[model samples]
Target: MTDTDVVVIGAGLAGSTTAAILGRAGIPTALVDPHPVYPPDLRCEKLDRGQVAILQKTGLADIALAATTFDGAIRDGKAWIARFGRVIDKRPGGQYGILYDNLVNVMRSAIPPDVTNVVAKAVHIVTGDDRQQVSLSDGSTISTRLVVLANGLSVALKDQLGIERTVTSPCHSITIAFDIKPRSGRAFDFAALTYYPERASDRMAYLTLFPIGASMRANLMVYRTMDDPWLREMRHNPERALFALMPNLRRIIGDVELVGPVKIRPADLYVSQGHRQAGIALVGDAFASSCPAAGTGAGKVFTDVERLCNVHIPNWLASPGMAVNKIEQFYDDPVKREYDETSKSWAYRLRSMSIEEGISWRIQRRLRFFVGAAISAACKIGVISDGDQFVPEGWTQRLRDRT
Candidate 1:
């Protein structure tokens, strides 16, 4: 481990993207994670407009966009997607929906080699009056001026920082996706998130069908059921539950199809009340996230990286010493804005479970609707200054009394 300008703790999209951008910007970066390859993460199926723009700006866009391509209904030309819960039907060149790992590979290749990419977990985050150091599980230390906690929701690391983040309800979520050939007269176009439009359980499950890769595929998400913990036994038992909820899925695949078993995990979305802490900044899911789990974490990570590169970097560079005040200001400003953008869509989806059950939660629903529509319109029209901070126009005010 060496002293670096930045040590990104997680080699996922956010980590890699930050490293790629920072390294290219001449800022030395180190990326840490546990051997980045994982089975394809299915639920997070989108690459957003802002992220698309960021990638394009960074010059890595074409590689990622071309590595994966889709055929079927094109929103603007790709697939229709949702952000903060409102379905975006106007994506130019459509929306991209390839497997999660596929995108990771595309991003990984873009990072400069000078930016060391290590496969290790960050075990301790030590903050001092000066530079910060991160202890790794591998018995190594990597020091940095700042650390970006882009790792998606890891309670362990958060605890290590003495950061007490709320679970905000025991709400958990998981998504499983696989490909299948179409039966005669039956095919699903790669447009719209179709399948489960309503909540089906305390699991609050929903199934979606999309044309992905070489065949027709389906993605299912079961939101926080008491019994199914993703890190536990769900992967092995996917088939058992698959047959129960979707008979068509069972029939379409039959025995010949290669079932890429279900992958489950808690799906609840959360954001820091403020920057998770100082000396460290939490970007993406470690700080802010969106749902129906719209793939906002990736977008947010890029936003964090862009802001760091464009805004934060200039300010930090001009300082003669540790810019504690600047860092703190940077952290606080985003926490407010990130949560504002992330909470509305996800909170609405969480509340959707209440609605389908006829809970008479009218006022909240109306506000959620207004906020969603207004935000969608604002984002579409480019009225919002930062695509990253689209707060669904008056979202907080409308739902002010409810939560």
Candidate 2:
């Protein structure tokens, strides 16, 4: 039997990040996972600028950025836009493209030397007001003050503890991933490209093209069933199915070829029920599952790790034993709740905006793009105050004065 102040189950990004933070803070922590070298798993491959900012706040951004190669621009079929510069200019980071397993390894590598790393499955967990005991499959036991569940959507652990999942949508969205290659046997024109669904029948949300190391990767997001024929075709013959669905991308990609097998992921939205218990807490996908189309999966998990490690855990530890009241404070946290809600909302929006045939959504779709275009035009023409004004900032002003 081994004992520690905190024991975190699952050493993926969420658990590893939590362990790293708590370990660095000089807290006795233990992180356990089934795989010492995590195998390949499909999830969010790239981190947007917004997600990057949250990671930056957690002090792990530099470590993650150091492991990847990024040049800071993405082309969305039309033209190349400086994604990091336009949205998060105040911060100096860009969209980062990294493999999911690589990311988890990088975070796990940052786990403090003092924190214990247990390589076994957490079979059962028993929680109490003062202490929690976790039983590993290897016949070892861990007794700790608190247990952090960062495991993704695994009900066996939660079910044993009498926790239920209130599912919002059982089969919310479908994601397909494949490698990108040029038919001419050369490099692509752009570093990255994001192509939106062309018509209503396509049933696609968007297709993101980005680089992961030397290989270009394409992730196609759609709102469809797992058994849909199109999905079958994608699995059997990915190249043809992909081109048939998003034909407009042919021009941008020139001649395209797919390198490996097409991977399919069915995303389900759900929030854990009865998880705010004494001496135990949940984080990352264990707390809630978000739609991949919404691109809120990583952001929500980062928020969970950030809030739990930095704010709530410190306050919880300063007191006596881990109680239900201390655990509830984290579940009721304003920022964490907001991010979870935003993910749910965006999941609905992405599905409706792609497949909804009603007049309301139709009008909304047009207006959304129109508003974005109007804002871009306003920024370009230097309309500072009113509609018909050309007031550029800094260098443009100096050029106007010279004229």
Which of the numbered candidates is closest to the native, going by highest TM-score?
A: 2
Q: TM-score of every model?
A: 0.71, 0.89
Shift in Å, residue 198, candidate 1:
6.4
Candidate 2 shows a clash count of: 0
Native-vs-model 2 lDDT? 0.80
After superposition, the stretches of candidate 1 with alpha carbons farther than 4 Å from their true spots are 36-43, 48-51, 54-59, 71-93, 185-193, 196-206, 222-224, 228-258, 273-277, 292-295, 334-340, 343-345, 359-403
Query: Model 2, 1-403: lDDT tens per residue?
Result: 9999999999888998899989989989999899998789998798865677789879899998888757354332222322211221111124578888999999988888999999999999999989999999999999999999998878899999999989979889988898989989987766666666656677888787777878888888988888799888888888889878876567667778898878888988888888889999899988889998888888998999999999988888888889899999999999999988878887887788888889887787666555545544554566633222354322232221111
Q: Rate the local accuracy (lDDT) of all candidates.
A: 0.59, 0.80
Query: In model 2, which range of ten residues has the least summed lDDT?
Result: 84-93
RMSD of every prediction: 7.0, 6.7
lDDT of 1 by residue, 187-272 (tens): 43335343323233434344554545655556665555546453244456655555555444433234323255544445565556
TM-score of 2: 0.89
